[model samples]
Each structure stands twice: as C-alpha cells, then as structure tokens.
Target chain A: MSDMHIDDFKHEALDHIHHHLKTYVSVFVALMALTVVTVLASYLKLSLTATIILALIIASIKGTLVACYFMHLISEKKTIYLVLILSVLFIAGLPLLTLLAKYDVPVN
Target chain B: MDIPYTVQPRPDTGLYNAKVGIWLFLASEVMLFGALFSTYILLRVGAIDWPEGVDVLNVPLGTLNTLVLITSSITMVMAWAGCVMKDFKRFRFFMGLTILLACVFLVVKSFEYGSKFSHHIYPKEGAFYAIYFTMTGLHAFHVICGIVVNAYLWGPGAKLWKKNPAQFTNRVEVAGLFWHFVDLVWIFLFPVLYLL
Candidate 1:
C-alpha cells in the first residue's frame, strides 16, 4: 500500500517480463530449428511408420514449446490445467475409439 | 456491473476470469480439431492407396507459412510482455508485427490454394485433398480471427490500457493464448498435410 512497496512491486513485475522475454526468444529459436529438422527429416524417405512417428515427435515438441512459453501454460492456474487434462483425455480417446470400431468385426 | 477478476486472480480459481474462459474455449477447440484429425486417420488407414502429400502439396510454401506463423507467435508473446513491462509503444509495435505476419501467412495460403484450384485439385478430388482443405482452411480461419482481435487490441481495444493497464495486459495475454493455439495447430498440420 505504501509508495515504497509499490516501487518494489514494479521492479518485480519488470523482472518477470525480462525473464519471460528471454524465454520467448529462446523458444523461438528452438522452434525454428525444429521446423528445419522436420522438413529435412521428411526428405529422408523413411518408412511410413518412422516418418509419421518422427514428424509427430517434432511437432509435439514444437507444440509444447508454443503452449508452455508463448501461451504461458507453464505458469497457468491449476483450473486451466484441469480443463486441458480433461480435454486431452477425450482427444486421445477419440482416435482410439475410432480405431477400435474400425477393426472390430463381428466374428462369423 | 463491472466484471470481477478482470485484472486480479479470483480466489477460488486463482486466475483472471478471461484466462479461465479462454482456456475452456481452447479445450473445446482441441476437441473440434481432434475429431477432424481422427477422421483423417480413419480415412488414411482405410484407403488402399493414399496420395503422398509431398508429391502433391507445395512444401516450400508450407514451410514458408510455418516460419511466418512461428514468428507471429513469438511476436504475439512479446506484445503481451510489452504490456507487462508498461511499454505502450513496444506493445503496439509487436502487436502490429504479429498482425502483419498473420497477413503474410494468409497471403501465402491463398497462393497455395489458388495453385491447387488452377490444377483442378478441389476438396472433392479425393479424401486426401478433402482433409487437407478442411484442416488448413479451418486453421486459416482461426488465423483471421486472431488478426481481427489483435488489430482491435492494437488499434482501439488498446485504449483500455490507459484506463486499466492490468486489465489490458490480461486481454493481450488471453489473445496471445488463442494465437499460440492456432500456431500449435499449424505446427502439426504442416508436417501431417504437407510433409508426411
């Protein structure tokens, strides 16, 4: 409430921004590097499974960087985490269910 | 009535109201795109002869757009950070840059789409093009939406900063969240549609 305390809070806020800015730049460089890696890997002519897995792994890492750094999910609230967790559960379930239905045939 | 928790974290949730709202919205978005992704997987698995994306789609353009979007994501984050630092000019610069990058992405995408159309490759061409058009089109729509929101924040919505800096910062943060989610979608889409 005092003016001294207000100045202290301002310094703290500025420090946080400085730290976040560094992270933003670092994540950006990493993302660009990974983009190049993904593109190059595609031309390697790996088998279908290897190709899919490798591409996905790179994409997931890139996605995580965006989510954690750019989206600020790394410091987000527990409520937000819960919402995402539930959504991810269903997102994961959707494909598994689809695959199951596709392969599940009535035995003659 | 003034909205509570616009600038301050709520007691129970420990986040500003918009922060909670945006994440919930993003969660649903994840499901929406996830369903389409599942459909893609289903169709690809069932098809006897799936077309190679690299053979059909323009990888160079896709790669270019990928870099554009990634750059926008960083700028978007920097814009929010600018607000956090109480630097209005910095915020406007980065926010405008983000919008411009989004525009570049759309321009590139339009060229890509135009080439496909000229080649008579519509969504009806086959399952591959169908999913390709559907996913990238949806992602592009999201990009447009982000541009509109960011333009407002940079142009008019930013007035809120003078009135309530904390709330304005929160708005940018929320917008950045959505923008990054769009970028995240493209990170996956680029490889899945253009490369793999």
Candidate 2:
C-alpha cells in the first residue's frame, strides 16, 4: 500500500512538471515575438532616448521571463530573493558611482 | 561527518547548501556585468560620433544565437524534469542537446568575432569595438564556463546519479539555474549591444 502511495506521489510530481512544459513553450513563443519587436524597433528611426527606453524595457521583460521560469526563481525561497536583493542594490550603486565620477565633482 | 546539507535543505535557509551557494555566485555575476553595462552607457553618451551598432553588428546571427540559447534553456529544464520522472534516458537526451546548443552558440559567436578581426577591426579601432569586444567577449567566457560545467555533468558526473539520485538531480537543477542565468544575460546583451 505504501509503495502504491509513493508511486502516485511520483506520478503527480512529474505530472506537475509536465504541465509546466506548456508554460515553457508559450514563454519561448513570447520571447521570439519580443525579439522580432526589438529588431523592428531599432529600424523605426525613433528618437535615441525613445529607442533606448524601448529596447531596455523589452530586454527587462525578457530577462524577467528567463529568470522567473527558466531559472526557477518564481518558486525560490526567501533566502535566494534576499541574495538577489543585495545584488540589485549593489548593481544600482555601480551606475551611481559612474555618475558621481562623471558629473558630481566638487568645485575646487 | 558527512556534509550537512549536500542533498537536504538546511532548516534556516529552506534550500540545499549548493542552491544558496550558486545564487550567491550569480548575485556577484550580476554586479560584474552591471559595471560593464554602466561603462558602455558612459562611453556611448560621452562619445561624439557613436557607431551605429545595428549597422556594424550582424543582427541575423545574433538573433539565431538568441533562439539557440532559448531552446537550450527549455531543454535544460526538461532534462531536470526527466530526472524527476525517473527517466534517465530522457535526461541524457535533453542534456546532450543542451551541450550541443551551447557549442553552436560559441561557434556562431566566434564566427562573428573572427570576421571582425579578419577585417582588421580590433578593439583598439574605436570606443564601439572596445565595449563590444569587452562585453561580448566576457559573455562568451561565461558561455565557455557553462559548456565546461555542463559537459562535466553529462560525462563522469553522470555516475553520481546512480550513487545518489536526489543529490544528482539537485546538482542538475543548480546547473540549470546557472545555465538559465547565462541565457538571461544574453537576453539583455542581445538588444543592448546589437540592436541599440
């Protein structure tokens, strides 16, 4: 009886992952669509600022999809998120450092 | 005594030791790439006549590599799923495909880089080539690292599966996370470098 229960549990777990296959396929399709859009946006002859914004926004979305699903961050624990938060904070600081060095020089 | 959380979740962290370790490693990777990205921005904004990246880069090739990496991500997850399902054959097939796709990406990338060098376009040519080579070359290094790790998992590391199935599967999952992170970096790099 216990063996039967273990078999069922394994089956259910595998089935859950099998269902995620569809999510993966759909995400792939969305990513491809976004890629096409990214290339097209480049040729749209928009303002430099607009183009940069659009490209980055699209890239951010793609990055999120890969991180959440492909990297399994969607179901990750609090500890992993904590680590990422720290990383994001430091990364955010990097640009600030550059900006400081570039334009924030104190008057002599 | 054996390792405390080799195959089991630590109580405080609610994750295996390796999972936490890889994530921490990935965190540092983010900062490394982030600094380079900031440099790219400063270089572009400060330069007088920035090169038209789209004109210089082969978009079709970059697109192909993006597709290839995305496909490998799916196969990688499927490989782990196969392990979960107790299907070693399926795992091997998908793992093999992931490694093959990684090799293809590197080959295509090298082709792109080689053509530039053959044209005598070195990183010293301009700020554009400097940032381009630095960013993509670093990314290519990550791809090489992924290939080495994945290759190990595919070869002798496969023995671990028979020794301890749970630990083996966890190792695959951790590796998948790294592989996916690599793909994530490319998703950003594709547009920022090539399209922008």
Candidate 3:
C-alpha cells in the first residue's frame, strides 16, 4: 500500500472493473456442472438426510460462483461486505428459529 | 436535482450511492427469501408423511429451467460488460437475449404451474404442494419483476445513454446485479424444490 501511488491503485482496480466474456462462459459451465451434480446426487439411494446435505452443498457452490462472479461481489468494497455480512447474520438466525417450530404440534 | 454519485464514487464509502443502495436492497431480499426457505425447512422437518418432492415435481423441466437461468446470467453479465466497453449495440443485443431467456423461463414455469393446477394439485392438496405453490409462486413473481426491470432498461432507459453514458452504464450494471441475484436464488431453488 505504501509503495504504490494512489494513481497506481486506481489503475490496478480498473483492471478488474470489466470482466471478460470468457470468464462468464467458464462460470456458466461450472454452474451447469454443479447443477448436474445436484440432480445426480438426488437420484442416489442414500438416506434422506444425506441426500439433502449433498444437494445443499452443491447448491451452495453454485450460489457462491454466481454471487462472486456475476454479482461482482469479489471486487466489491468493504461497505458492501458489511451489509451482506449483516444480512447473512440475520438470515442465518431464521433457520435456528425455525428449529423452535419442532417443539410445536405437527399438522400431520 | 440530478443524481449525485451517479457517475462518481462517494469519498467515504468509495462507491457510488446507487451501488451501495443496490447491495442493501439485495441484502434485504436475501432475508426475504431466507425466511421462506427456513419455513420450508421447518415444515419439511416437522411434517409426518412428507411426500417426496422428486416424485411430484418434474425434474427434467426443472433442469431445463436451470440451464435457462444459467444462460441468462451469462448473457446478463455480457450485457453489462457491453456497457462498460462502450458498445451500446452489443449491450442492446445481449440485453435482448437476457429478456428473451427470462420470458422463456416464465413460459416454462407457467407450464409447470398449469399442470399442477390442472391436476387439481392446489395449495390445499398437502403441505408439500402448499409450500411448492407458495415458494414457486413467490419466485415467479420475482421473475416478473426482473423482466419488467430489464425491459425498462432496454426500452426507455436506453435513452439515458445518449446524454449520460457513464450513468447509463452504471444503471445497466446495477440491473445485472439484480438479475444475477435472481439467478443465484434459482440455483438453490432448483435442487431443493425439484430434485430433493
């Protein structure tokens, strides 16, 4: 940070400001691969919990690629990350709260 | 007054106000969908005779829609890149592809929903179908919203490019961010709703 001039930093940042079409194609292919994995995993005769976990893991990978590349989160600033982290924190809590529903009566 | 930070970054945040605004909006959207997904998990975990989703949903159709969304995501980014490269014609072409893909997605989704309704598989059929209708119906609403946003940017919004090119490009990028978020949600929803 100290060595490079402020102008240099600006130039370096510009390099990533425009992503190439090739990267988008690669990401698209990766997403398709993960989608195939998810569908194939669902076809496996594993226990329900195992299948769910596997599918979610694959989905998470696909989601990560979309968010990082297409959403441009990888090149985003700290402020945006702060907002996203907060959102993730709050959203993560919803699932925990959902577990509370287990104590309630079942509909079926 | 004309919008501030439409073409320049704010000193403090080091980002244009619109960029910050979109991220905040997306963050909130994450929670909105997250809450529904949590409810799905809670419901599925608690239900006794939870029907198998694969048996009920058409996996082939879901897979095809996944491809549609993935292709749209690529086209969407290409559109935004076209803006960055100062090629309005390329931007319009890629954007048109994006809109077309979105319409195809909606058409396929409509067919899926139609079959369910025709078979009398209403939300009242059972818990699985209820959640299916609610979650997919909500997602479909989002698709409509995306279509409207992209369509506007392609039509009247393109006029902005003439007077304020930088700001117009920024707007396209912001719209692409939202489109990608929509695709991100589908990436997860496809496997959960259709396969698992």
Candidate 4:
C-alpha cells in the first residue's frame, strides 16, 4: 500500500514539472515573437520618441515574462516579492531624479 | 556543519535560504544596472547630435545575440525543471545547452566589438560608444560569471545530486534565477543599445 502511495506521489511531481516545462517553452516563443516585433518596429523609421516608447514597451513585456515565468517570480513568496518591489521602487526613482536634475539645471 | 534551510523552506519565510540570498543579490544588481541606464539617458539627452543606435551599432548582430540569450534562458529554466523532475540526464543536457548558447552570445558580441575596434570606434570615440562599451562590457562580464557557475553545476558540482538530490535541485534553481536575470538585462539592453 505504501509503495502504491509513493508511486502516486512521484507521478504527481512529474506532472507538475511537465506543466512548468510547457510554460517555459511557451514563454520562449512569446519572447522570440516580441524580439521580431522589436526589430521590425525599428525598421519602421518612426520618430525618435515613438521608437523609444515602442521599444521600451516591448522590452518591458519581455522582461516581465522572464521575471515572472523563467525566474519563477510568479509563484514566489512574499519575502521575495518584498525585496523585488523595494528594488524596483529605487530603480524607478533613479530615472526620475536623473530627469529632474537634467531639467533643473541653471539657465546660462 | 549542515546548513539549515538549505533544502527545506524556512517556517516563517516560506523559502529556502539560498532563494532569499539570490534575490537579495539580484536586487543589488538591479541598482547597479539602473545607475548605468540613468547615465546613458543623461548622456543621450545632453548631446547635441547623438547617433542612432542602429546606425552606430550592428543591429543584426545585436538581434542575433538577443535571440541567443533568450534561448539560453529557456534552456536554463528547463534545466531547473529537469532537476525537479529528478531526471539527471535531462538536467545535464539542458544545462550544457545553456552554457553553449551563452558562449555563442559572447562570440557574437566579441565579433561586434572587434569590428568596432577595426574601424577605430571605441569607448574613447564618444559618449555613445563610451556608455555602450561600459554597459555591455559589464553585462558580458556577468555572462561569463553565469557560465562559470553553470558549468560548475553541470560538471563536478553535480556530484551533490547523489548525496542530496533536493539540495542539488535547489542549487540549480538558484543558478537559473541568476541566469534568467542576466537574460532579462539583455532583453532591455538589446533595444536600448541596438534598436533605439
């Protein structure tokens, strides 16, 4: 009876691993498709502002996918999320402070 | 002494010790890369006439390198899954592929750098090349670190799988998280430095 139960548990673990593998492959495909879009968007010869916005958007999506799925952040615990969110807040602050300082320069 | 919470999750934190440690390290890395990105922005805005990345850098090579990194990321995650599934052969295969893809990225990147140098284009050339080499150089260094870690895990370090499979798997997951972070950085770097 115990042997049967152990076998069942092993099968269940394998199933879960297989599920995660499928998700990993799917994310890979999405990332490649986004890469193609990014290159094509560049070739569109859009204005600098438009190109920056579009490229950043695509990159953000790709980054999020890698973070959430590939890095397993989606299923991570509160402690990990806490650390990540804190760092993100700081990183977000960096560009804001940079831009503010850039524009606040003294007029010659 | 055997480490506490190496394989098992901590009661309060609900995560293994190394998991938390890697995330903390990655957070610091986020700040490191973030500052460099800010510098890039500052230089671009202050320049009177900044060259387009597509014009200055090899976009095709950059794009190819991006794909290579992405593929490596997938192999990395799959290797972690292999560990979870208790398939040592699968783990080794995917891990080996991840390292190979990383090498391909470095080779392509070296070619890009070599071409630039042949044309007398370098960090000393201007702000664009300066930030480009600084950011990508740092990133390539990280890639090399990833390769070293992964290769160790794939080769001799894998002996842990016999004595403690769970611990070995956790090690792979930790390494995979770092590898994925490297790939994530490239995802952003590709467009910012090459396309945009």
**What is the C-alpha lDDT profile of model 3 across B78-124, one tens digit per residue?**
88877766678999999999999999999999999899889988999
Q: What residue runs in model 3 are displaced by over 4 Å at the alpha carbon?
A: A1-19, A100-108
Query: Tens digits of per-residue lDDT for model 2 on B35-154?
Result: 998899889989999977789999999999998998898899888888888788999999999999999999999999999989999999999999999998999899889889888888
Per-candidate TM-score against the hidden true structure: 0.95, 0.94, 0.92, 0.94
Candidate 4: which docking quality band? Answer: medium
Using DockQ, rank the candidates from best to worst. Answer: 1, 4, 2, 3
Q: How many residue pairs clash in each candidate?
A: 0, 0, 0, 0
- Tens digits of lDDT, candidate 2, A56-93: 99999999998988787898899999999999999898
Clashing residue pairs for model 3: none
Between candidates 3 and 4, name the one with more favorable DockQ.
Answer: 4
lDDT of each: 0.90, 0.88, 0.85, 0.91
DockQ of 1: 0.62
What lDDT would candidate 1 get against the real structure? Answer: 0.90
Chain B alone, TM-score of each model?
0.99, 0.98, 0.98, 0.99
State the lDDT at A54 in candidate 1: 98
Among the numbered candidates, top TM-score falls to 1
Query: Candidate 1: deviation at residue B18, Å?
Result: 0.3
Second chain TM-score for model 1: 0.99
- The CA lDDT at A67 in model 2 is 90
All-Cα superposition RMSD per candidate: 2.2, 2.5, 5.0, 2.9
Candidate 2, residue B136: Cα displacement in angstroms equals 0.8
Question: On a 0 to 1 TM-score scale, where does candidate 2 land against the true structure?
Answer: 0.94
